[model samples]
Structure formats: C-alpha cells, structure tokens
Target: METNSMEAIVLEAPGPPEALQLRELPIPVPAPGQVLIRVKAFGLNRSELHTRLGLAEGVTFPRVPGIEATGVVAAAPAGEFAPGQQVMAMMGGMGRTFDGGYAQYTCVPAGQVIPFRSDLDWAVLGAVPETLQTAYGSLTEALDVRPGQTLLIRGGTSSVGMTAAVLAKRLGITVLATTRNEAKAAALKGIGVDHVLIDDGAVAERVREIFPDGVDNALELVGVPTLPDTLRAVRKHGVVCFSGMLSNEWIVKDFYPIGYLPRGVRLAAYGGDANDLPQAVLQEFLDAVAAGEAVVPLDRTYRLDQIAQAHADMEANRAAGKLVVLP
Candidate 1:
C-alpha cells in the first residue's frame, strides 16, 4: 500500500554529516508541469558536501541535498510520461532551491526528467544521471573533443574524471589522466587511461615530455588552484574546459585574461543542466553500460540512514568512484 509520507534526509543546517537527519515527511504532490518520482536511488556529489558544510551558495536551511535521482514515475499530471515509466531527474534547482532526491518521493519540473528503459540495478542507474551529463557535456559541448586527440583530465580519480576517460576512449581519443595518489594510478589504467600522470601540482612539463607540444585538450576538474598548470598542459590553439571544482577553489582573484590565459589557447567552461543532456545520449550511455561496453565506476552504495558515513567518506576522498545511495 502507498503511504502519504516518506522517509527523507533533511539538512536542517550546515554542520557535519550528522546534520543530515532522517525523518518522515509528507509525499510531495505534483503541481502543474511537475512529475512526482519514487526515488529509487541517488548519487552523492561534492556539491552536496559543500551544501552540507555551508560552502555552497544559495542553499536554504532544512532542505534535501541530492542533485540527481533515478526512479519510476509515480505521477505525472501533465501526461508527458506514463505512471510507471522509468526516468532520471537532475538539477533544475534541485537540492538547493528546493527539496531533491534524498527522499523516497520528490516532485520536480517535468522538463528536468529524462525517460529511459533499463533493467540495470538502481545503484548503477543512480550513478549515471549527473556524472554522465557533466562528462558528456564537457567533452562534446565544451571541448568538442574528436577522435585521434590527446586529452588530459585533472583529478583523474573523481567520478566525473573516470567517466570522462571511458567516454573519451570510446571515441578513440587518447586519455592522459592525473591522480595525486600514485596508488590510484592502476584504477585509472583500469579504465583505459593511455597515460597516468602523478599530480604534483605541475604535470604540464611531464605532459610535454610525452607529446613535446603538450596535449590536444585538457579538462580542469581540480579547480582554480591547478587550472594554470592545466592550461599549460594543452597545445597552442588547444582548449581547456574548466568544469569540476573538486578542490573547492573555483575563483581566480583579480583575473587578468591576457596574463592569466595562454595566447592562442582558448578557454571554455561547462556547468550544464538537464537541457544540455539529450535523452538519446543518456539512453545510449545506459545501453552501453548494460551491454558491458562501458562502466558506471560505482564505488559504494548506502541506505538513507548511512548518508552520514557516505558524506564522510566522500569528504575524506576515500572512494575511487561514484558513491550512490538507495533511498
């Protein structure tokens, strides 16, 4: 029998992982143009960690903090989707401006929903929505990476970084990723990284040692602290797309583009949402994973009560891949 309330992890205020309190809340009713999802699973993200620690801007108190969710439609008043249709929802102010996927049921704008068909485990499906969207958008929309190109990914062990490597390799692109922990180099290699550079804060010289002129493109996930060096790792006319902020330092103070950026190299950035991720692209990636042609790079799974441990693990960088929670 369906209940009128569901268990949810609510962030009452910024603090430690313990701040995420599990409680019973009323199931949200779908308004016009909104779809109510029975959230099967959700992925843990640094954005949520930041929100929990009072670092993320525009976050209100007593909010649920999941940026992405995968589930079946419980109700869709707009008739855009069937009642039992499988779908994923992400980032249309989810988790920040409003309650998100940390609950068993979440109501979101229908436009943010991407419908798909998959018998894959919810833990696996949970890891895809946001990670794939960011990686796909960064590669195609921001970098425009093509086959036969060499690409460098800063912060290689991150979920987005590892996922990007898999997608790039599938496109026949040579991937050179960086990881601070040498022990994790094999993890990168497992995902088909052509070369793994130990991130000593300056891998541009080593990148040049391999391809004298530097790489063809680079994805800066480490944020501003390493962006300058990342910029140096790319070739002239090559692009650097500033994407992830794994370092939690995004801004470059007193910016001067002339001196800050390389002369011929172009600088781009990617922070896309559901609109940027086409339904076809998402479906194709899911199908590839299901067929064993791709991987989800999932590190661990947790229940709603284990959210605190999950956040602690993520904060300590204990996981080598994406952390997901089955609500």
Candidate 2:
C-alpha cells in the first residue's frame, strides 16, 4: 500500500494556544510492538494544555497534544493488533512523548491499547479512559476508599472529580464534592453525589457540617491552596490522595493543624506516573464502563480543527464534563 500524508494539529512552538497549527504531516508507520490507529475521537486533558504552554517539563515542540482516544486499528506489526479492531488508549504520555491522537492517525504501543466492547460509542469511549483511570487509581489504589466512608473531591464537577464521585457512589461511599460554580451543584447531586459545596472561604465550614467529625478520605485535585483545607477536612488517620493541580502548583503557606498528625493521617500523591499502576487503573475503568457502573458525561464535542476553542473553554473553566475532539 502506498503511504500518504495526514492532517495533524502540531505545536510548532511551546508558547500559547495559537502555537498549535493544523498541518499536513507524513503519516507515521507503526514500529515493533506498536499499532497505527485511525483515530475516530479524542479527549482533552489539562496536562495537554500545560504541555502546550511550556509548563510541563521535558515536552518536545511540534508535538501532538491528546492523551486519550478511541479508534480502529489501521495497521499493526505481526503478532500485535489486527486491523479494524476498535480500541481505547489513554495515558502512557501519548501526546507528550510520542505522536498522539490529535491527528488523522496515531502510532501508539499495542500494550497501551485495549479493545472496546462492540456496543460502545467511539466518542464516549474516547472520553472515558483517561480521567476514569486517574480517578480509579487515586481512589482505589491510593486512598483505598471504602463503603461507609465519606470522600471529598476538591474539583467535584471536573472530569476526574465527577468520575471519582461516580465510582465512590457505586462503591456505596458518600461523596462530598467542591466546586466553585453553584450552578453545577444540582447536576452533581443528580449524579448521586451526596453533597456539593461551592469552593469559597466558607468551604471548610460547610464540609465540617456535612461530615461532622471530618471525611474519611479526600481526593485533592487542586493543589497547594486547597492542600491545607484537605488536611483539615480529613478525619484523624484518614487518607488524602493528592492528584491534579487545576488551579496552581505553589505550596500552601498557611499554618495547618499539625497537632492532628499524631492521629495517623496520611497524605499520598497519585497519577503523573503512567506505568504499571496506570495500566491496572485503565483496565478497571474499562471493566466498570463495560458493566454500566460508570459513565463519562461529555460536556462538549469539537472537531479537530477547533482545538484552540477547546483549550480556551477548558482554561476558562467553562466545561463541566469531559471535552471531546472528533476526527
């Protein structure tokens, strides 16, 4: 078969959203242990925006910037994937280290791709994996959240936050989510979240009202500024799983309740390491989605060319659920 060029959104330079340019680039060939996918749909993550703005370290310029995608295999090496098989892939630094899904075709490791159930929609499958996996990893693997426990998700309306809320609710745990937007509180409650608190100066007080003594676990997606509050919201011996920093990365300077440290409270960091743990998390999320226990609510969909608008929306904190890009 003759090779041909394909359209891709490339970050020619690391600067702003305008640096991302759509260009006709040569289609990549799958090497050993890798498969080339004809991407049907892809999803945006905050890390991709960080990479584009040169905030993420070690990212190469002229790179593609999508981490999660659902597509059909177009080519694979011997003993690997078969052509025309629908699959889902997320994490593994897809858009960071290698060419990623924001293109007509993406070459990724076969091990990173898993076959999706035949009944699943490509757009939903595309939006599900990444944030779901991260949420699963943080909750089950890191925090070990259990039934009867109260869990607080800092960014409750965020993609990962909502996924965590759903997973925790399925596990019979009470979920308390914090969002800056009061408008999403109703939606969060409708989705089975036990409580939704608008992120504000009174957040700690409101959380204390819901949990009384304190929550059993906290999923801190927003870093630094919220870390002190997260520590305060957890019961003694409770666990806090620090994940993403949607706000800022600076350390909190406020004095915290260090006297409570004798109670055996633990702070653990999760995600960003996309190796063995991520693979396990991915499998668990896929199983949950396949079982109908999990759902990825897509807030919006954009064509590949509208990536700039997607980033703008995300940066503006205007989206409530996962943002998808259709190829």
Q: What is the lDDT of residue 94 in candidate 2?
A: 86
Name the candidate that leads on lDDT.
1
Q: Write the per-residue lDDT of candidate 2 for residues 167-235, one digit (tens) a residue.
A: 889899989998898988876887789888889844667888877788899999877777777878888
Prediction 2 global C-alpha lDDT: 0.80
The models' CA-based lDDT, in order, is 0.93, 0.80
- Which 10 residues in a row give candidate 2 its minimum summed lDDT? 272-281
Q: Where does candidate 1 have its weakest 10-residue lDDT segment?
A: 59-68
Q: In model 2, what lDDT does residue 253 have?
A: 57
